[model samples]
Target: DDTPYDTQFCNWTVQSRFPSNQVTLGPWVNPTFLVGDFGLLRESFKNQEWGFQNWTTRRLQLTYNGLSWRDTAQVQFSMRRKAYWYTINIVIPSQIMWVMCYSSLYIRPDASPARVSLVVLSILTLITLSNRAFDMLPIVSEPVWITDYLFILNILCCAHLAQFILLHSALRAQDRRKKRKQQQQQQD
Candidate 1:
């Protein structure tokens, strides 16, 4: 017989079992709201040029688990939960940070990849740590906050690798150029 496309495989049967009673409801108190802001600074300066601008910063956010907690005494009865909150619209800034990493390809390969890669990774790691910190940040912490850190970290990671690859590629190109020059000179 051909396999049935709409075959019922489950059977319902009554079995003796004790009934359980449980109930859950929203927390008693409304969550408290607090607004905070922060920024990321990027410094661009010349060797010794006062004409050069200093550093720049981007504002961000720090979120705290909302204001709700169950006391040890109330653990037996009356349900309660820890409150939580996060930077509103965090994804927008995060995506922007990730997209910014595309600029790394513009850099020349003269710089060392090992060093640049570390810096890139550092930036990414900083972003990640900042993100984690932001995530863990409590209601009462610092004035500044961190948002989109993970997204930026992701971009920095990609850019760091790209820089390394670019450096390697440039190194290979230079090597080929030198080899060609040497061969031409020998022929001459």
Candidate 2:
């Protein structure tokens, strides 16, 4: 019962006992009446965040191998279901966060305190969201899309922090240079 996340699935079987029984067993017709208002129940099932595809395939074949003769009839019933939670919760938020992270780059670099604090908070928020993504998915070797997105977002946050530190150093250098110039002028 291990269903991979966001994967399509199907299952079915066939029954046969010589060609003689085929007439009695199948060529079955749909019943004129259903047991209940199952159609109403079906509508309820559709309300969830799932898309389903119902399908059926059947085939008949006859063959003679060197050792034996084989006659086969196969029937396959398939149902595909896709959940929307990842798209709604994970993807949308990650995209919004990415935009926010990029936008922070425009903040004035002289506002070092504000920039540092915002970057720290962004890192923490991304971490919490990544943990949530891990919890939601089945444990697997490869990362899911949301996980990858979060990792990239974290890198961007760190880059922003680094830029802030670099800007702080350059501004400090300028201040020292100005102080030296003022002292030299006073001595003259």
Candidate 3:
């Protein structure tokens, strides 16, 4: 699922009513033999999420179906989802959220509200993004690469929050020691 390119092959058989003994099927000699309108063909396969890939027609063949033999021709088409859409919608935004989470580390430890809020917001945004990405994909037993990327981002956000918690705790402890020393000095 993580692959950038997706290929799908469809076989369409045009079977002849006459048996191989009476008639035979052969590949089109002319490039534009049966193809009527090129524009219409392209438009029919056009998709928003998936771009149209190349299509090919296989050589004609004679096959037996118990009762009689027939001639058949196959046409296959391939298409792939546009990577730019995913990159724009999911990847870029998640990267921005990660940057925001990382930036919280540079904030002063005393500013607990700002630092905590930033990390928390980043975590929430990442969760929403992950959900959105997952919704776009079909459900499968195996994990997807986009989900894995988001999971890593969530972990990084958590690590940033943990760092902030530790810093805040140490700052509080230092303040408490200073207060205790001042109280003792005043009493003395």
The prediction achieving the highest TM-score against the true structure is: 3
Model 2 score (lDDT): 0.60
TM-score of each: 0.31, 0.65, 0.80
lDDT of each: 0.41, 0.60, 0.75
Q: Between prediction 1 and prediction 2, which has the larger lDDT?
A: 2
lDDT of 2 at 94: 68
Q: Model 2 reaches what TM-score against the true structure?
A: 0.65
Tens digit of lDDT per residue, candidate 1, span 20-50?
A: 3212222323223111111111122122212
lDDT ranking from best candidate downward:
3, 2, 1
Candidate 3: pairs in clash: none
C-alpha RMSD for every candidate: 22.4, 6.3, 4.4
Give a tens-digit lDDT track for model 2, residues 103-125.
66778878776677777887877
- How many clashing residue pairs are found in candidate 1? 2
Clashing residue pair totals per candidate (backbone < 3 A): 2, 0, 0
TM-score of 3: 0.80
User: lDDT of candidate 1?
Assistant: 0.41
Question: Which pairs of residues collide in model 1?
Answer: 66-83, 66-84
